[model samples]
Target chain A: MKTLSYFLILAFSGGEHAGGGSPLDVNPGLILWTVVTFIFLLLILKKLAWKPILKSLNDRENLIKESLEKAEVARKEAEKLIAENKLNMQKSEEEAQKIIEQSRELAEKLKMQILEDSKKTANKMLEDAKAEIERKNAEAFNKLKEQVADIAITAAEKILKENLDKAKQINIVDKYLNEINKN
Target chain B: MYTGQELIGADTLKQVAETAKKTDTSWIMHDVLDANEIDLTPFGIIHLPHLNLFGFDISITKHVVFMWIAMLILIFVLKKVAKSYKSSLIPKGVTNLTETLILFVRDEIAKPTIGKGYENFLPYLLTVFFFILTCNFLGLIPYGSTATGNISVTATLATLSFLVIQIGGIWKNGFFGYFKGLLPHGIPAWLIPIMFVVELLGLFTKPFALAIRLFANMTAGHIVILALIGLIFILHTYVVVPISIAFALFIFLLEILVALIQAYIFTMLSSLFIGMAVHQEH
Candidate 1:
C-alpha cells in the first residue's frame, strides 16, 4: 500500500509538496468566492476603465487622421499660390520691357524731327538778312547818282545867265553818256 | 564542507510542519486548502473572514484580497490614463504604456483571433489581460501573493471565458445550429455520437488547460525560487550561497517574462475560442 501510495503520488500528486500543504488542495469556498469576485471586477472595470479609455483612444486616432489630411490640403494650396505669383511676375516684367522699348523708339524719332526743323529755319533766316542788305545798298547808290546830275545842271545855269541852248547841249551830252553806258 | 548529516535540519523542519499540521486552529486548514492566509512575513499573516451560506463555504480568502488589490490598481491607473486622454490625445508616461498594451490586446489578440466581429469582445479580453498581468506581478514582490497562482482564481477566469464563448456562439448561431456546426459538414451518422463526445470534451479541456497552465506556471516559478534559496540552508554550505542567489534572481527575471506571456496567452486563447464559436463556416 505504501508502494502504491508513492506511485499514486508520482502519477496524481496525491502527496503534499515541500511541507504539509499542497498548492493543489481543492477548496469549494475559494472557487465560489473567486467566481463572485471576478464577475464584479469585470463589471466595475468595464464601466470605469474600459469604456472611457477605448473611446478616448478612438477619438485620438480619428483626430490624427483628420489633421494629416488637412495638412496635405494646405500644402497643395500654398504650392498653387506660389506658382501663380511666379507667373504674374513674369507677365508684368515682359509688359514693362515692351513699354520701355516703345518709349525709346518714340524719343529717337522726336529728336531727329526737332534737329531737322531747326536747321531749315536757320538757313531761311540767313537768306532773308542777305536780301535786305543788298536792297538797301542799291537804294543808296541810285540816290547818290540822281544828286550828282542835279548839281551839274545847277552850276552850268549859274555860269550862263539865260542860256537855254547851253542847258540843251548839256542834256544832249548826258543823254549821249547814258546811251554809251547802256551799250 | 560535507557534514554527512546536514539533513538533520530537514527532520526538525518536518517536526515543525507536523506540529503545524496538528494544530487545532480553525484557520490553518483554510490556509493550506484555500490560500486563506496572506503571508506578510514581517507584518504577520492576515487571516481573512470565513463565511458559510446554505452549507456552502463561501469565504473570502487571501486570493480574494490580492485579486481586489490587483483590480483596484488596474482601475486607478487606467482611470488616470482615461482622464488624461480628455485634454489631449498625445500619450505620455503611464498613458503611453497603457495605450501600447491596450492596442496590443486589440490588434494582436482580439483582431486576428476573433476576426470580423472582434470589437465586441475587446472589453473582456483587455480586462483579463490587465487583471492577470497585475496579479502575476504582485507575486514578484517581497511578500506579495500571486492571486493567479491559486487554482480557484484561475479556474474562475476560465469559467468566465467558457461562458463568453458559448453565449457569443449561441447569439450568432441558434442553439441547434451552434451544436450542428461542431460536426463537419457531411459525416456518417455512427460517427455523430463519438464526434459529439470528443467536441464536448474539447470544450471543457480548453478551459481546464487554461486554469491548470496559469496556476502551474505561476506557482512553479515561486516554488523554484524558494527552493533555490532554501538550498543554502539545506546543505549547510556557504559555497552554494552565491550560486543559489544568482539562480534565484535569474528565475525571478524569467518569472517576469512568464507573467506577461501567461496574460497574453490567456487573452489570446479566450479570443481564439470566441472566434471559433462565432465565425463557424456552417
Candidate 2:
C-alpha cells in the first residue's frame, strides 16, 4: 500500500514542470492532496454528520405518522360515543312517552270508578229515606183508629143507663137487643 | 480583451530568462518569477510556499490552503448542527438551514434520481454537494482561491464519481453481467465491437463533462472578475476604479449564484449517473 501510494505520488508529480508557460498548468501534487482531503472529508462527514441527521429526520417522520394515526382513532371513538349518546337519549324519550300514556289511561279509569261509586251510594240513601217515611204514616193511622173505637164504646154505655129500670129494663133490653139483633 | 499587466510582466521575465541563458549576462538575476516579483501563475493570484514530500512537490499553494479552510468550515458547522440535532426534534437557526439543504439533496436529487437505492449514496452526494459548494464560495472571497476551479481538483472529484458509477454497476450486476448488459440484446455480432466502444466512451464522457463543466464554470467566473479588475490596472487611472469595482461586484454576486448552481449540477448529474448504472433497464 505504501509503495502504491508512493508511486501514485511520483506519477502525479512527474508532470509538474512540463507546462511552465501558462498558469493553466496541472499540478499532480495538488491533485493528490485534493483526493486525499476530499476522501477524508467524505468519510468523516458520513460518520459524524449524515448518519445521525438522517436517522433523526426519519424518526421525526415516523413520530408524526403515528400521532396522526392515533388522532384518527380518537376521532372515531368520539363519533361512536356521540352516536351511542344519541341512541340512549332516544330510548329514554320513548320510555317517558310510554309512562305518560299509561298514567293517562290510569287516570281515566280512576275517574269512571269514582263516578260509579257515588251513584251507588246516592241510590242506597234514597231507598232508606222512603222506607222511614212509610213506617211513620202507618204508625199514625193505627193510633187514630184506636181512639175512635174507645169514644164510640163510651157513648153507647151512657145512653143505656139513662133510658130504663133494672128487671123491666132487662126484659125490654132483651126484647130490644133481640129486635136490634133481628134488624 | 485587454490582457492584464501580470501576463505582460511574466512574458518580459520569460524573455529576460531566455536572453540571459543565451548570453550569460553578468547582471541577470537568479529567479525571474521569484517570490519577490508579482505572481502571474494561472493557478493562484498570490504565490505561496512550495512544499515537497517524498520526492513529490506537495506545494502549499493558495488553492490547497483554501480547500483546507473550506473543509474545516464544513466540519465545524456540520458537527455543530449534528450536535444540535441530537438534542431537539425540530431544527432551528443554522441547523434549520443546513437541514433544509440536506433534505433537498436527499428528496429532490438523490431520491428522484436513485430511487430505492438513494440511501446508499446519500452521504456521498451530500459530501460532494457541500465540498464543491464550499470550494466555489471560497473563490468569491477577496484573496481565497477556488480549489474547484483547478483542473486537477475537479478531475479528482469527477474520477471519484466515475469510480462510484462503475462500482455500483458491478455490484448490482455481476462482473460478467455488467459487461454484457452494456450491449443491446438485438445488435448483430458484427456491430458488437463498435457498440462496445461507443458505450464505453459514453460512460467516460459523462464524468469528463462533469469535471470540465465544474472547472470551466468556476474558472471563468474568477477570470471575469480578475479581468474586470485588470481593466483598472491596464488603464492605470484612478478614474476607472468606480466602474470596475461596480462591475466586479455585480459579477461577484452572480458568482455566488453560479457557485450554488454548479454544485447542484455536479451532484444531480452524479446521482443520475449512479442511478443509470445501478438500474440499467434501457
CAPRI-style quality class for the chain A–B interface of candidate 2: incorrect
| Model 2 agreement with the true structure over B1-282: per-residue lDDT tens digits | 235655565566566556534543221111110121223446545557777788998877656777789989999999989899789989999999999999999999999898877899899999999999999997776545678988788988999999998998899888888888888889899999999999999999999999999988997777777767766766668999999999999998999999999999999999999998887775
Q: CA shift at A175, candidate 1, in angstroms? A: 23
Write down the worst ten-residue block by lDDT for model 1 chain B: B24-33
Question: After aligning candidate 1 to the native by TM-score, how far in Å is the CA of B132 from where it should be?
Answer: 0.2
RMSD of each: 7.4, 11.9
lDDT of 1 by residue, B42-143 (tens): 888888787898998877777778778887898899889888988888899999999999999988989888898887898889999999999999888866
- Where does candidate 2 clash, by residue pair? A23-B42
Leading candidate by TM-score: 1
lDDT of 1 at B132: 96
lDDT of 1 at A149: 69
In model 2, where do residues sit more than 4 Å from their true spots? A1-23, A104-183, B1-49, B229-247
> Looking at candidate 2, what is the lDDT of residue A26?
68
